[model samples]
Target: MRESDLIYILAMAGVTYLVRMLPLVLLKKEIKNRFLRSFLYYVPYACLAAMTVPAVFFATTYVLGAAVGFFVALFLSYREKSLLVVALAACAAVFVAERLIQWIA
Candidate 1:
């Protein structure tokens, strides 16, 4: 809306890009240490769990509904395990649940 807000947003965007790019630019070489590389492998799972577990419970029943959808997706994707299928299942579950609730209330 204002010039100050635009400058602040641009500055933040630049900072975020620099922070993310710095790691890739710096770690261009393959890590030699086996232990460290092994540890790095868990980083994605750990970060996702850390971010999601708390939010799942803190948020609404949507999380539980998503869990149901995840299972459904898992089953539907049992042979191929496609990400698209999983995402569709989760979104469909949300939409159906909301509509069902509205009809009931």
Candidate 2:
């Protein structure tokens, strides 16, 4: 790799590291506010959903398969299934949907 490319990558790595690390280092006291604590507790799940939802819609060739998978996942999740079960159910739903689509077409 070029020197400039190495420098740019290092700079990006440093910035990303600092952005994540500074928060923990600066906030030494335990959070006391109930509302803030609750919000913080759910932040990771919220972030995960935000990141994964869009990808789910576009992950397959056909929108129908993706939609089927999404609804299966949503239903299993609402029913409080284990994470592994929910994931496998969604994958199976998508696979079946895709095969059905292929057979029909």
Candidate 3:
């Protein structure tokens, strides 16, 4: 609402845009290194896991429920199940585990 807040937000937006855009604009040529290219390719997945893994543990009230869901998802993924199936299976596992825990407690 204030002029100073608007200026600060614009400054932050400009900095973020430049940080993301500069790499693409400056590196006009394709990356050629096998190791570096591979690493770059996996950065998004690594970031995603880093962000998601922590939240998954706290998704349920019971840690055991979350752990069961995580293991079910991992097992399904390891078996090469489709993403939808893996997600559904993990949710189901967590739901069942949580219900069991609630009933016991």
Candidate 4:
């Protein structure tokens, strides 16, 4: 790899490490503030969804299929379905939607 690429990678690693480490180092005591604790509890889920939702829309060949899959997954999850069930149902929805769209087009 190029020197510039190596430098960029090292910088990224250092930043990521610092971001993770600083929180642990700074928050030595258990956070007792109810609001802060609640907010922190949901932070990981919010971050995951923020990162994942956009990719879901672009991952499929057609946006329509992805939308169908996303809604199916959302519905199943809202109903408290098992992760495997939700995943399979979403995949099936996407597959069927894509096929229908392809056939129609």
RMSD of each: 2.8, 2.4, 3.2, 2.6
Per-residue CA lDDT of model 3 for 1-105, tens digit only, reads 999999999999999999999999999999999998999999999998998888889988888999999999999999999999999999999999999999999
Indicate which candidate wins on lDDT: 4
When summed lDDT is taken over every stretch of 10 residues in candidate 4, the lowest stretch is 48-57
Model 1 lDDT, residue 73, Cα: 56
Clashing pairs in 3: none
Global lDDT scores for all candidate models = 0.74, 0.95, 0.95, 0.96
Candidate 1 lDDT by residue in tens digits, 38-62:
9999999899779866564434455
Local accuracy of candidate 2 as per-residue lDDT tens digits, 23-81? 99999999999999999999999999998878889998898999999999999999999
Model 3 off-target regions past 4 Å? 1-29
Model 4 agreement with the true structure over 1-105: per-residue lDDT tens digits: 899999999999999999999989998999899999999999999998998788999999999999999999999999999999999999999999999999999
Per-prediction TM-score, please? 0.75, 0.75, 0.66, 0.74
Candidate 1 is scored at a TM of: 0.75
